[model samples]
Target: MLSKDALDTLFTNARTHNAWLDKPVTDAQLQEIYDLMKWGSTSANCSPARIVFVRSDAEKQKLLGCVSQGNFEKTKTAPVTAIIGMDMEFFEKLPQLFPHADARSWFAGNQANIDATAFRNSSLQGAYFMLAARAVGLDCGPMSGFDADKLNAVFFAGTTVKVNFICNLGYGDAQQLFPRSPRLSFDEACKIV
Candidate 1:
C-alpha cells in the first residue's frame, strides 16, 4: 500500500489543471512518464498508445488549429501538449511484446477485434499516462475537444494511428484552479458482487 501522501499525490488531491506556470517540462520528465506508464496492464499486452509531444512552436501551432475554441488558450500556453494516439495496426508488434504466445494472430486481419482492442487498451493507457504524469510531479489537463480528423491528418498522416485524446503537461497554475468537483461515493458508483 502507498502512504497517504503518495495516495494524495496520485488521486485525492490531484486536479485537472486548466492553466500552467512558465516552468518547462523536460525531455527526461516526459521519458520518465512513459517509463512509468508502460508498466500498466493491457489485454493481450497490446500496448497501442503512441504519443506525440508537441513542444515546439511549429507543432503547437499545428495543434492549435485542431483544438476547439474553448481549449485554445490552455493548450497554447501549456509547455508540453501530448497527443495520445491509438494504432490500428498495433497487433503487428505483439510478437515482440508478448513473446510467450501468438498474440498477433489473434488481432491480425480482424478489423473488429483490432479496433476494439486498440481503443480500449489505448484508453486504459491514456489513464495510466495521467497517473504517471501526476506521479512525476507534473499536472495534467486532458481534453477531447479537438477535431480528431484534422489532428490525425496533421500528426499521423498515412499511418494507422488515430488520435484518442490530447493532454497538456506542465507545472500548473494553482491560482487558476477551480473548486474541485464532486464525485460519486463508492456505494453510489460501485456494486459489491
Candidate 2:
C-alpha cells in the first residue's frame, strides 16, 4: 500500500483547481503523466483516450471560444488545457493492445458496444489522468462546461474522435479553491455482494 501522504497526493488532498499560478507546466511532465495514466486498466485494453494539450496562447484561444463563460478564464490562465477525447475507431488497435485474442472483431460491427466502451474507458482514463497529474505535483481542473461540437471541430478535425472533457493543468492558486464538498460514506455509496 502507498503511504498516507502518497495517497493524499493522488486523492485525499487533491483539489480541482480553477485558478492557476503563472508557472508553466513542462512538456516532459505531461509525458510523464501519460506514462503513469496509460497503465490504468481498461476493458479489452481499449486505451482510447486521445489528449490534445493546448499550451500555447493561440491554441488556448481556440479552446477558450468553445467553453462556457465560467470556464473561459480558468482555461486561459492554466498552463495546459487537456482536450480529453476518445477515438471512435479505438477497436482497430486491439490487435496491438490485447493481442491474446482477436478483440477487434468483438466491436467491428457493433456500433453500440463500440460507443459504450470508448466512452467508458476514455472517461476512466481521464480520471486516471487527473490522479496522475496530482501524483506528479501538478493540480488539475477537469471541466465539462464546453461546447463539444465546437471543440471537436476546432481540435479534432478530420478525426473520428470526440471530446470527453477539458482539464486545465498547472500549479494552482490555493486561495481560489471553494470549500471541499462532502462525499458519501462507504455504506451510502457501496454494497458488497
Q: How does each model score on lDDT?
A: 0.97, 0.95
In candidate 1, which residue ranges exceed 4 Å CA deviation?
none
lDDT of 1 by residue, 1-193 (tens): 9999999999999999999999999999999999999999999888999999999999999999999999999999999999999999999999999999999999888999999999999999999999999999999999999999999999999999999999999999999999999999999999999
List CA RMSD, all candidates.
0.7, 0.8
Q: What local lDDT score does residue 58 receive in model 2, on the 0 to 100 scale?
A: 90
To one decimal, what is the Cα RMSD in angstroms of model 2 from the true structure? Answer: 0.8
Cα distance off (Å), candidate 1, residue 130: 0.8
**lDDT of model 2, residue 77:** 91
